[model samples]
Target: DVKVTQSSRYLVKRTGEKVFLECVQDMDHENMFWYRQDPGLGLRLIYFSYDVKMKEKGDIPEGYSVSREKKERFSLILESASTNQTSMYLCASSFGGRPGYTFGSGTRLTVV
Candidate 1:
């Protein structure tokens, strides 16, 4: 089975601090995505990378960025974490957009 792993299951950060969330997929999928899910908001894409060193901004990319230096690995960076950024961050991957999307367990972040 394909599996996506996130670095943290829960995180607490203060406002104005940089945050890093790591993700790795064992399937070596070509597409990796970062999304933040909130109550009543569903899943909103933050960024996605189709290949190494290439990325595309998704629906909500402000204050967030991503890196894909190697296959099977992707990272999300919050330049300056904020209270509004406190949400459940999810990492997902797909094999050439087939088989739909496989998501990580998610990182529940709280900013105070």
Candidate 2:
């Protein structure tokens, strides 16, 4: 099994609905992040947490929120799903300020 796991591999949501993407890490990493990938836009950071209950906004945090109530769990919340938000979401974790991240198999979300 992968060290980092995302709750869903694929999801479909209606516009204006709330959506939650869950990710869990088994390695006890100190940093966890959420990113969205598009056809040519590449990976854009949406949110991140360095420790439990601590979160920071990343490059594309607008329309997205995050929760890190526990060390092993990090959740990304889309308050209102939109077609513009449809993309592949990635969850990653790292420890000791390492440059590399262990990523979960991405979640493909489609908003209609």
Candidate 3:
């Protein structure tokens, strides 16, 4: 079972509210990243994990946080979302020792 699941396909939130994005992988992967996709910015890494319970900040970590309490579950949190945070959020699990990743369908967030 090699699947990466994202909790939502479309989400709408207001500025200054907290938001949560959930992801799960059934492949037992040890590494993955939360990326935000914008038209011009492309894919920007928000957070990444080395393994369970351990994480590292990526390119854009100022407004986001991640939780990897379990091997299969990872959560992205937006403490105080702003309008600029509106974008597609993707969760991808890396293949062990390989330079590949299995990506989720992505959650399109609209923060207004």
Candidate 4:
């Protein structure tokens, strides 16, 4: 079975502190993505990497960035965590051009 793992299940951050959320997948999938899920807002992509050392900004990449140095790991970094950044962050992985995506449980981040 494919599994995506997030570093945190819950997080609380100060208004302007930097934050990092890590995700690792054991499936050796070629595509890894980061998304933020919010109530009524649906899932919005933050970043995605299709290959090692390559990254692309997703729909909502303003305050966040991602790293993918290896095929099995992806990291999401918040330049400066803010109240507006508080949301459930999810990591997902999929095989090349596959229709369905498998997601991690999610990290509920609260920036106060």
Best-fitting candidate, scored by lDDT: 2
Q: What's the distance in Å from true for residue 17, model 2?
A: 0.6
Clash counts for the predictions, in order = 0, 0, 0, 0
lDDT of 4: 0.93
lDDT of model 1 at position 49: 89
Model 3: how far residue 99 lies from native, Å: 1.4
TM-score of predicted structure 2: 0.97
Residue runs of model 3 more than 4 Å from their true location after superposition: none
By the lDDT metric, which is better: model 3 or model 4?
3
lDDT of 3 by residue, 44-69 (tens): 99999979999999999998999999
- Per-residue lDDT tens digits of candidate 4, residues 4-98? 99988999999889899999999989999999999999999999999999999999899998888889999999999989999999999999989
Question: lDDT per residue, candidate 1, 1-112, as tens digits?
Answer: 7699999999999999999999999987999999999999999999998899999999999999888989999999999999999999999999885868999999999989
Off by over 4 Å in 1: 97-99
Give a tens-digit lDDT track for model 2, residues 33-103: 99999998999999999999999999999999999999999999999999999999999999957889999
TM-scores of the candidates in the order shown: 0.96, 0.97, 0.96, 0.96
Clashing pairs in 2: none
